[model samples]
Target: MKSETVGSATLETWSVEEVEQAFAANEIVLIDVRTPQEYIFEHIEGALLMPMAFFKAEKLPGQTEKRIVLHCGSGIRSEKMARLAIDAGVTKIAHMDGGFGAWKTAKKPYIGTDMASGAPKRVG
Candidate 1:
């Protein structure tokens, strides 16, 4: 059975905690659907960038078994990219409800390309 609580509704949507747990359990993959700069500025730990502009980037990290969670600064771009991922035959696609901002607000850990402080640093 599905083991995650998303909201007050019966339908469970992916939450920051769920994503974190998935990462901890090594059951999911995080993908940043923002620009390369934004990705370097901030993103979840281990999240690979597939900038929304390059729609095709979705195909690069093509792995079906992994539950793919996509996120952006505010969630909009991630939602769009999630659809693309789904269209590309990725059925286990989801978007961060509130996106990176919410993830930061929840105090979830992240790692930037520059430093390992869990805060956005810089990309090499």
Candidate 2:
């Protein structure tokens, strides 16, 4: 994980492993900043949906309760949203470095769609 000062706020960039570990420990809030269509198809299990188009810092979970980690399809949008949150005066924010693509590349498990049956299933 790496963090930098952004005005009065801090922005953290963490690798997929860091996010996965913390999430498994229930120590951080994982937020998916992707479209509903993308999320409905597949997503990290337990991640909360807050599409980029509708993202708002105030709508984010309190940082005081659990550290929030944002993620998207390929790390682009999530990083944008994290900076936006910081600019909105969120004291601290973070985003997964490579997003869901990296998570899948790393062979991490996620909730993926079963196209044949139109059902959700665990994928690794």
Candidate 3:
């Protein structure tokens, strides 16, 4: 994990592998801050869709036992949101570095769309 400063807040940026492991261990609440369209195309399994356009830091559930991790298409949007969360007085929050793209590059399992069937399919 790497830490980045956004304003006065320090955001923890985690690699895809780290996020994958935490997810597999049920140690994190993975949130996808991408658009609904993007999420419909493909997304990490069990990731909650909280589109950046309408996301509010206050909307995040208080997760004392589990870490709240954010992710997007790339690392950009998620980091932005993480900063917002921190600024909103959320003491603990993390964003996935390199986002879904990196996860795909790492060959992590995710739910993808089937164009013909218009259904969710598992991809690794």
- Which candidate gets the maximum lDDT versus the true structure? 2
lDDT of each model, Cα atoms only? 0.68, 0.94, 0.92
Give the per-residue lDDT of model 1 (tens digit) for 1-124: 1323223212124777777788789877787878888776666768877788886734646455676677888878877776665555554557777788888888877765545454555332
Task: Give the per-residue lDDT of model 3 (tens digit) for 50-124.
Answer: 999999999898987899999999899999999889989887789999999999999999999888999999997
Q: Candidate 3: where are CA atoms >4 Å away?
A: 5-9
TM-scores of all candidate predictions against the true structure: 0.72, 0.97, 0.94
Worst 10 residues of 3 by lDDT: 2-11
Runs in model 1 lying further than 4 Å from the true structure: 1-12, 57-64, 112-124
Summing lDDT over every window of 10 consecutive residues in candidate 2, give the lowest-scoring window.
56-65
Error of 2 at 103 (Å): 0.2
Clashes of 2: 0
| Candidates in order: C-alpha RMSD to true structure | 6.4, 0.8, 1.3
